[model samples]
Structure formats: C-alpha cells, structure tokens
Target: MKRNVILLATAIAAIGSCNEADTSKTPPTNDSSQVKTSTADNKYVNQPLVTHIYTADPSAHVFNGRIYVYPSHDTATGTPENDNGDHFNMMDYHILSMDSVGGKVTDHGVALHIKDIPWAGRQLWAPDAAFANGTYYLYFPVKDKKDVFHIGVATSKTPEGPFKAEKEPIKGSYSIDPCVFKDDNGSYYMYFGGIWGGQLQRWNNNKYDSAAQLRKPAELAILPRVAKLSADMKSFAEPVKEIKIIDSTGKLYKEKDNDKRFFEASWMHKYNGKYYFSYSTGDTHNINYAIGDSPYGPFTYKGLLLAPVEGWTNHHSIIEKDGKWYLFYHDIQLSGKTHLRNVKVTELKYNADGSIQTVHSQK
Candidate 1:
C-alpha cells in the first residue's frame, strides 16, 4: 500500500484452454527448445517450481497443450539491508512454459524488457497475455516518465517470444492489471484496475472515463472494471463497465472492512458455463474469487481461494490443464523478503457445487 500511495501521489497509478499443437497459425517464436516435455513419474510438480529467479503477477494460459506463464521479473532494489521495500520495482517480463500439467518449466528468457519500451519507466508491474489472430499479445502496465500509470501491449509471433512493444499505451487506458479474455463467440473483453481508490474506468476512443471521474453513483475507489476490446485488439470497442464484487444487501464496500470487494488483480475464466471472477483483495495478502453467468459480472463474492502468505503481496491466475485446475501465484519464501517473489502453482480443487476449494500451499 505504501508504494501504491506514492504511485497515487505521483498521479494515478495503477484465460482459456486450447487443444495441443494448435496448427491454425504459426507459433510466436521459433525457439523450439523453449517447449519443455517431461516424462516424470507424475504429471504434477510441487509449488515454487521456478526458484532461481523472483517473479510476480503470474498470468497462466494454455496453448498447444502447454502452459505458458507471463510474470513480472523482480530484482533486488540495489539496497541490501532494506531489500524488502513497500514499493514494487520490476524491469522486465519472462515467459515460462511447460509441456503439460505436472511438467518441468522452461524459462523462455526475457520476452519483454523495460529498457526496450520507449514510453515506460522503471516500474513494470503486472502483465497478462492472450493468443489471437495467430499472434501473442502481451498487456502490461508501467509508469510513464511523468509517473502516471498507463497500460501498453507487446506482440510476438509465438508464445515464447522476443516481443516487440508498441511506442504508445492502449488508448484511453490507465491503471494496472490488463486482462484480456476472448469468449467463446470470439469476442474479446478486457478487465483492469488497481491500487488507489478502484474507481473503475473504461476506454473511449483514445481516453478513459470512470464513474468516479464522471461523478456517477459508482464507488470512486477500489472496484474492478470490464470493457469490450476493439476488433483489432488495440483499444476498447465500447465504453468500459464497472464491476461490484460485493452485493448491495450489505453496507457499501468501502464501509465494510473485511468484505471481499475487488481490490487489485482482476482475473476471469469460464468453467462449466460459469464465469469465474477472481482477484487479490485490498490487503494484498489474500486471494479471493466470485462467479457470474456472464463475462462482465454482477458477481456474488464466494470466498477466499488463498490466505496470506510469506509475502505481503499476492496476485494470481487460474487455468485448467489436462483436466485439472491449478492456481498460479507468488510468495517471498525464496528471498525471505517481500520484494523478490518466486512463482508457484498448486492444484485447485472444485467442490461438487462448482465452487473453488481453498488452496493450501506449503510455507
């Protein structure tokens, strides 16, 4: 929250499966070695699989029967004693993948770096990716030189890629996590928000407008947003829609301290025809989820999917692989500090009623 506060004072800050070996289009990258195949006793592996590097904001996707993860790369702040600062300092993104569920992960190296982005500053925070039109699109948020957070995109011919970033950010888009979901009908929707007062906003033409900014009845801060993406995938096709995680039966979300209202990391996936909207709470330590009938939801907040971990921050994504569901998240266990986090995955269990079971990761 401290880093987020500074981000605000500085001015605004800030998945679906497919068959194996999709042959409809060419892969984004030609690096065949990036695809990892495992012949282990079990198809599954333990949590904290990638230990050598610290990664956060894991966005997991299934492509060509493999799982590709896009995460923010975390490095020491260059200050040893206070390595664990409240602020987030990320500079690059790595695309990690595995052949299947329970397989070994192949670090695809630096897919996108801050130095390469012409408009980005040092703080390259959360990112998410999607495969469409035979291309892999990476959506990320970074603070501009003016210290305002803006969302931008990078593109690669393959999932494991040396992505080429655009010179500018998504028109009219601001704030943090940019999650793009392509529905069954081939329509694309984007969900994004975070940090300072979640006044949800939408992309209009080349700028953004929010209920709070418009003086609408919507809560000015701390609610997530959903909007339809343009056919070309560069901007919003329509006005952005706001999402309220908590119901109106109770007191206003901001008034309820322990409520599971949307805080930051907004993720959406469809299971059994039910749209699951999951996110990390305002506390940053816990992860929670809700379900709706459609993409943009009037969701009913179910409950916590993950409790607090060693790190003060937690962001995640969920996907089904080989008939099993898994939660991709991060923790500070490796560095023994909050700033440097490592990626981890745990089996996600769903009860008979289609509700997600609480995840228990090894400390």
Candidate 2:
C-alpha cells in the first residue's frame, strides 16, 4: 500500500504547538483499544451500516427509507496535473445511496455538477443536505475567484436532483462550509466559516444578496450563530441572534496573528437534549470537537476527534446510522497536499456522560 510522508515536519510542528487546554479533558494518553471495547465487544463489526472505501466527508440523512450520502468528488490527487492552478476543480457532487448503509449503494452516480448551477462557474466544495416538509435542501460552497467564495443553495422534491439553484447565492459576509440545522421548536439555522480573516455570520432572511448587505463585516468573528427562518425554510425571520459557539483563546496548534478565529467547518446537532458542535482546527487537518448546553454559545472543548494519520490531515463530518454514529472525514493518503485528500469513514461512539470517544483510522 502507498503511504504519504511529505508533510511529516509540518504536521509535527502543528501538533507540537497545539494547546493542551483544547484536549485536556481527554488527555492524549487515553488507550484507543479501551475506548473501543468499553462500549461493547465490537458491536459494529458486522453491521451493514459501515462502508469500505471510495467515500469521504460523508453527510448522511434518511429520505424515503434510504440513507443518502453527499460528499465532494475526490477528482484531484492534490497533484500538479489535475490541479490546473488551484487545489481543486470543484465541478461535481458525488451521491451514493443504499437501502441502508453496509448494504449496497444501489444508486451511485454524479447527482449534481457545477455546470448544472446557473451562476456557479467553478470551484465546488463540501456539501450538506437535509429534507424538510416536501423539499430537499443542499448547502455547499463555491469559489468565484481566488479569494472570493460564496455559499449556494439548491432545492428539489427528491433527494437526488434535478435541483434548481436559487435566483442568487446565499449571501454572507464570508462563505465556506454551509451546514443547516432545525431545532425542536420548529426553526431553521445555518452555520459556516473557515480559513483565516473571516467570522461566522447569520442571516435573518434565508436568502440574501451578499454578506455586505446581510450584516456588518465586524460580526464575522462570532464562531457560530443561530437565526430564525420562515416556516417554508426559503426565507429568514426578523430578530436574529449572533451567538458565540467556539472559544479559541489558546486552542490552536499555532496561534497566528489573525483577528477572526481560525475554527472552520462548524456543524451543530442536538443529541439527548444538548447541543454538540463539531469542527476542524490545527491548520484544517487536526479535527477537534466541543459541546454546549445550547446551540448558540459557550461550547467547551472536547478534544481531538482524529489527527493526521499516515501523513494525512483530517477534515470530517459526524452522522448517525442504524442507532450508531460514524465519523466521515478526509485524509491525504496519496500526498501531503490538500487536493489529494480522499474521503474515509469510521464508526464513532459516545460516553455515558455525552463525550465522544476519540476516532482513529482503521489499519
């Protein structure tokens, strides 16, 4: 099997400088085998919910008694040939579906492509999907230029589209990694932001022209926030709340001089009555998680979910299937660069106290 060792020095440097305060609750010394066996004796071994390969950063949801996975196409190897100039082409969305996971992904094909969208020219990235009422909403990021990125939404009556893009992009101050969550009280909210120099922004109107008109630029640093949406889920309501979800005082592997917090890939889900926010940190390859009593604020660091294993930086998604949780993430198995990263999946477990057990790559 091929292995990646190019980023060894950089990975060490990043890991070495990571603040222990971020992962102090569950120290690095926790035994991996012990955590796995603590829940049950390999209860996940024969389950049909686990996937073997060819999928990564999976965002899963149940629609019509089937599990549909929407992940970015691993078209580029982060190599020079496929990476014309930038790291990725961002052209297509790969869709896989099964009557149930671990079974067979009966319908596997390119469900949506970049050219399919009206305004999108190129650069499609991570996408998240959810079904509400009678419509399926898919949220994703696309780059219009070198630094100009934006999030766009598409809706369809079925999980696999024929999805039609809105009249314009979902305008925000900064755009990347858009995730949607609906609360128990019947409200919808979206959270997203990554890289440096930008902050998370929430919109009262689900559809807006641009981040500039959505809110002031100064409001971006609030890690994650919640907004109220109209019942149709196509527009937002008045009186939005910009809640601070992540506290990045001394959590990064390297705290560079940047005003906006470096935390990206903000995902919010409520499990057992508490909100759990999972995100990527430590230069985008080191995955970390946090928990909060509410979706909006004061999340406490839970620690590293999975690190760069076999020379790969980890970017991930957490999904629950058949009464079990799985971590869907990406790793550069072919090279140290970002474009070559391939998607991977593994089982996830939670402790009795609601803390997630650390995740590792299966050898």
Candidate 3:
C-alpha cells in the first residue's frame, strides 16, 4: 500500500486534461488517401507510419524476434504550456518495431532518446522492456534535482537500443511505472510504484549492477516486497516476504464497490496456474483486474480490461501469442499533441473464473 508519489500525482491529475493547443492550428496534411494501407506484401505494408500526438503509456515486449514499442513522447500539440513548458516539458521515450500480430513493419525509429538520458532531461516517463540473458532491460521514469521521482535502468544488447545507463536513479523509496516479471521459478521481478508513495519492489539481481544494492528507507517501506536474486541475473539474496496485495480501495478481497483505486500500472502475470494482477485505475485512463493464487496475493476482482474509448484514455499491454489474447492500448486522435496518441490492438476474452471481458470501443 505504500505505492506513493501522492498516489502518482493523484493518478496523474485524475487521468487527463492538461489542455494545450493554440499554436495556430494548421499543420496536419499528410494524406496518402487517408493512411491505413497494408497491401499484404508486408515490410509494414504500404508504409507511411507517422502517428504521433503524444503516444501514451505503452510498453510492449517480444524481444529477439521483434515487437518492441515503448511510449511517452509529447512535447507539443496544445497545452502543457502549449506543449512543452512544464508537464515536465513534455516527456520522452519512443521505440517501435513490428513483425507479427497483424503483421508488417520491419522497423520504426527513435530507439531511445530523452536527450539520451542525463537524468532524462525533464520527464521521460512510463517505459518497460525486458529480454534478460541476451540483455535489453529498460525501466524508465525520471525527474530529479529534487523535483523528486526516480526509477531508471538501461542496457542494450539490442532491442534497437543505444541504452546504457548503469545507475543514476533506482535505489528506491519511490519510483514510477516500471514492470518486469520473469518468475516460473526463475525469479526476476520488478513491479514499480505510483501516487507519491508507490511500490512493489524486488530486483535485487535481474542486474544493472543491482543498482548498487539499494534497500534502506527503513528497508524501503516494506509493502509487497520480494528480492532474492543471484544466479547470474546479478545481485540480492535476502529481502523476501512483503506481498500484501491491495486493500485501500484498490479492491480484491472479492472486489465489488471498493471499486478501482490502485492508479498506476502494476501488471504481474502467471496465467493458467493463476496469479494475474493487472492494474491502472480511476485515472491513468481506467483499466482494472486481479486474480491471485499467489505471487503473493489475496487477489480476486477481475473486471474492466479497458475503457475511455471515444474519450480516449486507456492503459494496457496484455500479450499472449500463439494461443491468442492481445490487448496493447492507447487512443485520442486529431494528431496534434505531438502526434495525437494512437496504438491499438484488441481481442482478449476470459471468464470461467478468470474474469475480464466487459470493455468496449474498437471503433
């Protein structure tokens, strides 16, 4: 329950409404007859890719065979002071690639840039990538110089990354939106925090020099801990047992009326054996669900997988592959807030006891 940052800036100022625009309007015109093409020969079909109005909280990962996609890049389009005056000067981090899943696209640009780090020169929020042994880890969030807010780590054997930030932040008391899971017994966990106090730590070793071995803000608030590492993943071997799993209104004792409040991406997964844990709520564009047999849980509320469609605002990632699943989210159009945020994918169902299914708008 420590998940803070004033509840992640009160769930990012209640989910949306930063309002900027008036740079004089006119700049749009790029119509190859209105885009969307896809003649099927692939390589990203007919190609023209340029949808940018400030892509939001994405975070996809497939790794080696490709599928990258890390979002957050809006420096302009109408209001954080006409686009970049504050709102942390518009934020950063953009990386995209595609190969399958509606197939096409061989590559897209901006592998990693926020002026290339240096404390992320201003916001650089919500990134999450992971490949492990062959390397590629990217867990973002920055804004220092006492403006507070931490979370950092970058490496790159190539997910198209020039990466490489060993440690400048990430030692922890409060960080934001990072999610990396590996467990099947192989360990590796790193679920980030939000709302001014956010939490879900563990990473004593999935490497990055173990961020100099953190752990000491009274052992870092303790709510939902894990930490055990050291089999070449790189560090920690002690702090276990903190998994309290939700209950301040974020629901899950069977969830009903306690109705969604967690607010900041969480996303831990397991599947067929159970343990789900998806998050984001009341604000961050509303998405919620829970399940838990144990990756530390008393979890239960499994509902609302996505929402805010025409009003545009939803946060997700859901992946599954061969057997199907998919979800990946983002919306809000008109193409001006840096591009207007677009990135969509659908098809997800479940409910025999697993729960999720009631969210609409694919149009």
Candidate 4:
C-alpha cells in the first residue's frame, strides 16, 4: 500500500481563509469511538455518525421508518489520479441507519464495492438511494477505463444490500455526484454535476440518453442540472433543465462566489409546499441552499446552512424526519486528510419565511 502524507500546515495554507467571518471551529477530537453531543452527560446521538471507517459525500434518505444514509467510503490509500483529494481513494459504499433521531447508528457494510461492477473504475464518488415498486435503487458514479465518469445503478430488494450493479452505466449520464429524488406524485428526478465545468445530465426515454446536449463550453451554465426520471428510476425522462440560482430580487446569480451558487452535491427536500434545493459551494467547504416553488426551479438563493469544516471539500444531503430537518455532511477531521473524510450530522433550522438559518459544525 502506498501512503502520501500532505503536510497539515501547508494544506491549510493553500486553501486560504474560509469565506465565513468566523473560523474558530477546530476539527473535532477523535478521542471517543462514536461522535456524540458536546455534553457527555447528554447521551443523545452526536456528530460524526460512524467511526469504524471513513465516509464522505452523504446521500441520506428516510425509508421504512428509519433514516438511511448512503455515503461514499473513503480510505487512506489507493489514491486516484487527477482527483482533488490528496489521498481520496474510495472503492466501496456503506449504508448507515438510525432507528430514530438521536439514536445509535448501525453500519450496513459494503452495499456496493467497485470490484463488483464490471465497468466501474476504482474511484467511486457520491451516491444516492431511493425505493419504489418494492425495490431499492442505489445511484452512483465511477470512472470507466476511458477515465470518463459515468453514473451506474445498483439494485437490491432491501435498503441494506449486497446490491447488484447494472451491466453498464446509465447511457448519456457522465459526471460525478448522482442524487435521486422522488417527488410526492411518484415522479422521479436525478440531480448531478461537479466542479471545473462539469455539466449536469437528465434522464429521459425510459433510459438516460440526453434530454438535450449540454450547452457549449462558452455557454455552459455553472449551476447544477436536473431531469425527470423514468418510472423504474433507471433512465432519464426527456427535457432536461439547467437549474439557475437567482437572488432575492429575481435576478440570476452570475458570479461564482463561494457564498452563493451551486458547486456540486445537489439535493432536494419538500416541506409545506416549498422545495428546498441544497448544495455545496465552489469553495468545497460550506453547504448552502436555496428555495423554489417547484422541483426544477429558478431558485432564490438562501443563506449558507453549513460553514467550512476541517476538510477542503464538503458534500451533503438534506431530509426531514419526525417534523425536524437534519443535514448530513462530511469532514476530514477523523482521517486528518482532505480525501479520507467522515460523515457528520447536525440539526437544521428554518426561518419564519421558509429560509434556512446558517448552521455551525457540531463538536
């Protein structure tokens, strides 16, 4: 095994200062086996949901009365080429769950590993899960031998699975961070994209082929992309839409400031007839969100929901359970490297007008 150590001092210096006005939040101490609340007396569930292995890019969902978190597994070795993390080499995924809020987490290990997929490359990025027609589906992204990232689907009868991968990736879908969304009417949608000019693709034609070709490079839109999913949740539904982030005044946000705009990890949640579109910013630290009247939206940019953690990258998902909302995100505090990140959860709050309040990291 090859191990590369990125000096903590140099790594911190290169990223410059965080975009937040306050930067005093230090990485959580790895002393305890499980991430618990700050007060030892309160036995409630804490941050850093799991401790046995590194987990990042959390795609959380509620299924069968339990909160299921599908997060990309991270390790200290097997670093892939040309990736951002100094040691980001993930090969498998783990399904974590909690019976109730502030409850213990159970690790359903090895739901899908890279070696099981014939066409998948070693680099397994972010993923999301959904249940329909008595079947559970895991949507994931892996680079192929051609080095192009493609989205693939794995199916299993249960949420915790030894999932079986499709023979090939979802055609026409090529990017990282694949998130599946199921609307109230039983319609499905998948949102995906990445930094450095990655374009979001939508599913259509009972299978993803491209509702429309992505815009030309010069005309490429920086926001995340979305499309309706077919009934089976396997392919795209034609007519893709590029999601634009608009300011309060109803003007489109043009600049790529870390404070606003979608960088990657697009996720959706509906509450009280309003759609909440949340994502990680370009700085790859804070998790920000916006609100819209519909799934595909000219969303109005809301304030930051999460500030930067100890890692150089941040990816997350949002879901409401038992009348409360929670944010699942990843941080490098456990492994102490950008690539080997661990998943964490924090309480989320909303203002009276339906805008989200900024969240701080839970120790």
Query: Candidate 3's residue-wise lDDT over 161-183, tens digit each?
Result: 76776546655424467676777
Per model, state how many residue pairs clash. Answer: 11, 12, 29, 6
Query: What 10-residue stretch in candidate 4 is worst by lDDT?
Result: 14-23
Error of 1 at 118 (Å): 1.4
Q: On residues 224-302, what C-alpha lDDT tens digit does candidate 4 reach at each position? A: 7787888867788765567878888987654335457566788888877988888876554667778899888878887
Provide the overall lDDT of each model, using Cα atoms, as 2-decimal numbers: 0.69, 0.53, 0.51, 0.69
RMSD of model 3, in Å? Answer: 19.1
Residue by residue across 123-242, what tens digits does model 2's lDDT show? 677788877888998877776544456677788888966567775566442356666777788677776665432223232332333343323243443344445555666555534445
Candidate 1 regions exceeding 4 Å error are 1-46, 79-86, 197-221, 248-252
Model 3, position 143, has a per-residue lDDT of 62
lDDT per residue (tens digit) for residues 1-363 in model 1:
111110001111001111132322332333233223221211112345565566788999998888899998887666443322225777778778878655556777778889999998757888999888888899998878866678898898899888999999987677788888889899989999875432233333335454333223344334677889887777788876777665546333552343366668888899899888988765545678887888987777788787665566778898888787878887664565666776777667788999877764431
Q: On a 0 to 100 scale, what is the lDDT of residue 113 in model 2?
A: 70
Which of the predicted structures, 1 or 4, would earn the higher TM-score when compared with the native?
A: 4
RMSD in angstroms, candidate 2?
A: 12.0
Candidate no. 1 TM-score: 0.79
Better of 1 and 3 by TM-score: 1
